[model samples]
Target: MSTVAVPELAVVSSPWSLGPLHLSNRVVMGSMHTGLEVQDDGGAGMAAFYRERAAGGAACIITGGIAVSDEARGGPDFAVFGVGGADERFRAAVDAVHDEGSTILAQLFHAGRYALAAGMVDRHGAPQRVVAPSALPWAAARGVVPTELTAAEVERTIEDFAAAARSARDTGFDGVEIMASEGYLINQFQSPLTNLRDDEWGGSPERRRRFTVAVVEAVRAAVPDLAVTIRLSGADLMPGSSTDDEVDALVHDLLPLGLDGISVGIGWHESRTPTVQAAVPHGAWLAYASRIARVVRASDHPEVRVIASNRMTDLRDGEAVLADGLLDAVALARPFLADPAIVDRSLAGSFDLVNTCIGCNQACLDRSIIGAPVSCLVNPRAAREVAFPARPTTDPKRVDVVGGGPAGLAAAVDAARRGHHVTLWEASDRLGGQFDLAALVPGKEDYAATVRAARAELADRGATVHLGHPATVADLAGSDAVVVATGVVPRAVDVPGADLPHVLSYEQALRDGVPAGTVAIIGGGGIGVDTAAFLTESPDEARRATEFGARWDVDVAETVVGDVPQRLPAAHRTLRPGPDVTVLRRSGKFGQGVGITSRWVALGRLRDAGVRMVGGVQEYLRIEPGVLWIRDEHGDEVGVPADSVVVCAGQEPALPTGDEADGRPTDGLVTGLQAAGVPVAVVGGARDARSVDAVRATSEALEAVRRLAP
Candidate 1:
């Protein structure tokens, strides 16, 4: 594989100014919630997380949204800025970011109606009531209407914003940004669908803009010296939401009210649009920033810089957009999460080593939504910086790693970095066991980059890699310690006629192509859903277009639909139909264990591809030549006729089995080896059968190597 050469960045590394604040560069760390505040140090873990990014050369760091009022809190773990007893607690966070020579901005927010449904409690330990412009619930709130804020409550809310900004200024923060996007309280007041009041807060465009404008004015008045920015939704992207013109008009009205800068945030939580997912085209939201930049340049407040955000993965992309004068600076949230030194490395021209974010959102947004601490899928030390330390070994030893999958590769590289001689052996010709299959799934090509990076790191660290060489007990005879990461194998089902040629495991189907005909997949887990999508070739625009044309009887030759047939004359004729696929599972829900952030996109793609999904199966009776018999939820046996049946019933730990081995779980390998006077450890899927994702496997590998080094 050829390397993707990094282009020379032009304006991305240059210094920029946002009103009174002077940034060292154009790269800004956008605000993202990190559940690290659950620690006991009064947000010290969260502070350390931000400090790392600042020390790595991010020009400015905007802290995650901090609630101003007790009723505005999202949860107990969320940080609070101006609440009565939390002044010193937030000052420590600001001091940490400032110690790294980076300007820190506190993002003050109020969750509003979303807070009540989020189970947020007040200072007195009672469930907070949701408040908005009108008595409407967000789509995710399950029809629970919010209490309308009275006229006096609206006045008090504005005062709360003022107090938050004043508290930030007193706490030594350089600035404060009003969290006015992403379906939060301020955005609810600006959006037409959420703000349906007949009072001064809602009614027409001017009345709707009253709440935001008043908050800005009050915050600016409260902290005249501090930089006051507002994060606005460039496009709500929801039905009956604010339009581009309305956003433009709102920006026009807010600029005169002492706004220092504007950060463009795309989409809301309830938006049906694909905003930050991997499937979204790179720089797809740049045009929205450009539209706002055009509006900002036209207004009298030209000093208010426009920051472009969403799906910006590389500095070259930011440089290109910055050179085009569409945006003054670029904000990156996930990229910083993936690599804290992203800016410094790009500036030093070490692009190959920089770990770019794959936009998976698995560990970041998805985990945060479930009230878990945010961590990066590729970088295990993101949130747990203190817990996962990388220290050189005082006494180096020879290490043998028996696997070339993610866990083994990680172990080899970490051991080599820690002054140990390491050798990694793989039974297969290539690396990345199930990860390779995962990369082949639709909209997941970015996963291949991870494998490439691991391979490159191993080569650079001088770790010996032996492919197609299955390790035996003899290989570990001379080694001081051994790490086994043999990974997992698909569990076999005990249904009748399971040995039929028509039945294939998920790995088998991925290795050998799926048969062309009706297919029934057992187990609606992540693997099964991904396999169904793989067989259907979902989200492939050309395939979807062809299928659409075939279903609706539209002639592609005459009509120019979706700009495909007109551009490529042979697209219509070269289109091939995918196989008819159905997914069967014993559980009620499909795609279990899939992240909430990307689950809808995955399931929506399956639905669009005409895939049938039936869950709540009581039993699998049997699998015949071209038929699968299963008992449905109604206790009635049904025969599902298909050309092939694929089983993705989940994985089991692959333990050693031979005369020399006792066939025990891999965790016992360490104790057995220690009994024999050899220091050995187990990592990755071999360590456990559940929750063996890339993040856990890599972290376990690093920890295991650290333990064995000394």
Candidate 2:
């Protein structure tokens, strides 16, 4: 691999004056729910989290939804603007970002009926009824219906937005962005599918947009001196929702309002389309952005900047969209979580040095929807910066780290950066243990960037890395400390047909190859699901936004952009299914360990690929020449014909090879290191491997290395 992959980021690195707010660059750290806002310290913890990203090089920081009203909160964990001590904390956070020379914007938010929040109550402690334009229940909210805001209450809600903007201006925010996208309060009022009222809020398309337009008008009046913007659902992606023409009409209405910016956001929270997931291609929503940009530019107020956001990761890709001279900026949310210094690194012409976001959502989104503090899988230091500040060690010594997987690589990086002499050994020829195999899965090519980042970081810190070298007790005899991150090996499924030649482990299927023809997968864990996905390389995996819109029954005459919904008319070829794949679990949910935010998207891909999933395996009978017999719950014999069977039952901790001289079978090198009066640390899969998780692995490694003394 080369030292770096430089990005063409001229437009993104250039400064721009967005109305009253003069930004340092076009790379905006878009709003995301960090869960630190509602912490007991008010906003102190969140301030530290934001301060780091601003200092790292985000030009403008958009805060996660700051609740405008208690009843409209996204969740119970969201901090209401003037409630409790939030005002004081917001002021402190503003000062922190300003000290870093970055502009911060407070995004006034209201979740409406899409409140995934539970047990929400008002200031008086009575149960709060989630309010919306109509009394409709959010599809994913588990039958929780919202109260229809009376015409008077609707006016009050508009007032709430204005008050929040005034509070934000007084609290020292450089700008205010209205959170109207993602199926929130204002967006609910804009879409006819959710806003079914016959009143002034939702009779026609124009009336449906009245709520959002009024809020924008009020917010601008409250914060006349600050840069004001509103994030709008460019397509909404919902069936029977606002169409392209309707959204364009709304844009024209807002253009005359002299708003500072108009950000085009794609996909509502209830929409079936995959918005920011790994399956979605990079720059997927640029076309939606272009539509709004053209509308804004042709309007009377071209000075009102247009911003594109969604499924964007690279600065160069963002600049590519900006090079057309239509879009004023690009908004990125999760990528900043992966690498806060993404802009600074790219501007310095070292894009490869930046830790790219793989769109796994395991650490960030999965945690946020559950009201937990959001962190990054690739960069575990995010959100916990105050608790785990990076500091140089007073004393340095030799540190031998066994296993060059996620845990070991993380240990080496942490130790080396702290002034320790670090050495890493991996039994395999490659560094990434599971990540290398994971990268082979469709839509997961970014997994390879993690390996590249670890390798580059280790090399830069002068850490010794030995591939295909398994560390033994003798190898760690002279080390000050040892991190046994040897990782896990496949757990065999005990059954009559376990030894069949057709049976391949998950590792084998990923590395060697998945055999051609029909395939059967045993186990429905995350690995099993991914293996099944890898087995069938159907055209469905390459589905673009047009197909996504078509599948969801969305009207996309001018809304969606990308590959056409159907194969090119000139091809004149019928689509063929890739392969016949089946996943059989003993008795558990499919994609069990996968995050909620991405599990449905993965399952939907499998359905499109024609992959069948079968759960409730009563018993495994035997394997014949080309069929595996099994017993169902009804005691009926069934045979699944398959040319290959891959077992993804899971993994177990693996100790290093040839390291049990004293017959201490379980503790191999760890026992030797401990008995020799040398410090020893057993972390990651080497300690417990009931499951595979890079988040837990890296966090464990950080704490283990931090506790280790020379």
Candidate 3:
């Protein structure tokens, strides 16, 4: 790649001006459940997380859900903001973020009936009934019944919110956003389904909205200058639940509570939507945001600005929402993971290459549930800021990168930060190869974000980019050393239909849309199963009519429309693209190829989608025209008819021939120059030291680099 001048940036523009606080930019970091703080000093860990983002360039930071009271905590390990009272530690946390130059806020929450009190047994191991508006069993853990909050208990709980808010102000936090969304305590009180009470706090929409109002009024009165925000789930994505009209009514009712703004959020933790928020486009949750804006504007609450979130990842999308007046500002979570300097990049006008959130719920939501420290799937530096900050090394080292995928990108960025002049080469124009296809899968967009962030880091680090250029012994011409990150190649299978014309690989299928025909995918691994799902029809039923077009034959739709439910089912199903695709298990069943944890989740989606799964590859035959041979569950050989055949078996590395290796690419004049001696190092999937083949190849490369090293 040729050198290009990066435009200068103006640091003056900002996105929010709430009360006495003037935020530098519209990019707000949403609350993330950091498991690090859940265990030890909540104050220290919480402060570090916020300080990292603040230092990295977030205009405003919202700390993860801090419980208002122990009884209202969603889990035992969660941070308790209400416990410390108006203490010195709390003040220090607020001061920490302020010192980093960004305004910070604490999200005061009460999980209510959602709290797993049983898990929080005392030292002697006894169960407890956490208080709630009504005596209700936890939806997730049905046997656990929560105690109904008496009139006094309810009053005390409201006081907890007030106290937490007062403490947040005293601690020097710029603001506080009340957590009322995602079916938490405030949400439970807001919804009639959870609050089946006869008192003034239940039965009607006005009554249901009372608890939230009381907390807001208390918080606002306690901290006059602090930007008081409220986060609400406009649509819970639950069936037979409160309608949008009811939610709007609740918002209007709370508009008079003197809130600085209402931050709109969508979806529950267990929501089926790949992108949690509803009414949002692929990358932008404009619909849900627009609704929130409409509700607030319709109320004519001049003091309350609507801050929109839910799938708003890139600055371009944030700018669009701001331009359309749908929202005053946009809040994000995963984008910061991909690139901590999101705001700086946006200001520089390189928003097109901005690393964004691909909606992978792994490090954030998954780890939080498992009680593990929440980190980014792509950006490994998320929770390691204080301990392993990404800073340049004292002295520079000449480095060479072998692959151009996630791991390679990570290594390259880390090396560049160490002040290395790096050269990263890919034989193709595309930098993200397999990752590009991975992102095409539903909810796997974060893979692309990882790739984008890698490229940005490389550029910022001054790493030399060489595309469509293969490295040879001659290319190793000059350099202190090299690190081979050569990624893995596809694992080819020797099957009867392997050489068939229609038998396309997973990469090929993503590059080209799955045709409307009888599609049969071979292999039951993560890649194979996911490939099958993609080849089938989409699980989104609302778009089925227009999305199918002329391809909507009754048989085709039925075959493609597997068992994945449109709503969150009693049993969750793995979400995959379904457009008349079938799976033929060669050895193991579905999800065998993916990672264990991810496989279990994917298996659920597949089962829910009602996919026709066949085990064992022994019943196989040949790809004779439109027919495929497979054995049924009864161990009988069956002939399945298909219009197209696809192979998603996986990948391998592409190495040069012996002639090219010997510096004698005399086959073509051009091939000779392509063999320019270059020090190449490979990494990623195939680089696992345990694998004999990978070990040998790696050893050979290390030896070669050693010979060339000066």
Best by TM-score: 2
RMSD of 1: 5.6
| TM-scores for every candidate against the unseen true structure | 0.87, 0.93, 0.79
Local lDDT at 617 for model 3: 63
lDDT of 1 by residue, 132-163 (tens): 78888766666767889999999999999999
Candidate 1, residue 135: the lDDT equals: 86
Count clashes in each candidate, considering only residues at least 3 apart in sequence or on different chains: 0, 0, 50
Best to worst by TM-score, what's the order? 2, 1, 3
Off by over 4 Å in 1: 1-7, 82-89, 116-121, 124-129, 139-145, 390-400, 410-422, 477-481, 500-502, 538-579, 618-626, 629-641, 659-672, 690-696
Residues 321-363 of candidate 2 have per-residue lDDT tens digits of 7886899999999999888778787787876677889998989
In model 2, which range of ten residues has the least summed lDDT? 559-568
lDDT of 3: 0.64
* lDDT of each residue in 648-701, candidate 3, tens digit only: 665665433333435454442124333443344444454452321322342343
| Candidate 2 residue 213 C-alpha distance from true site, Å | 1.2
Worst 10 residues of 3 by lDDT: 552-561
| Number of backbone clashes in candidate 2 | 0
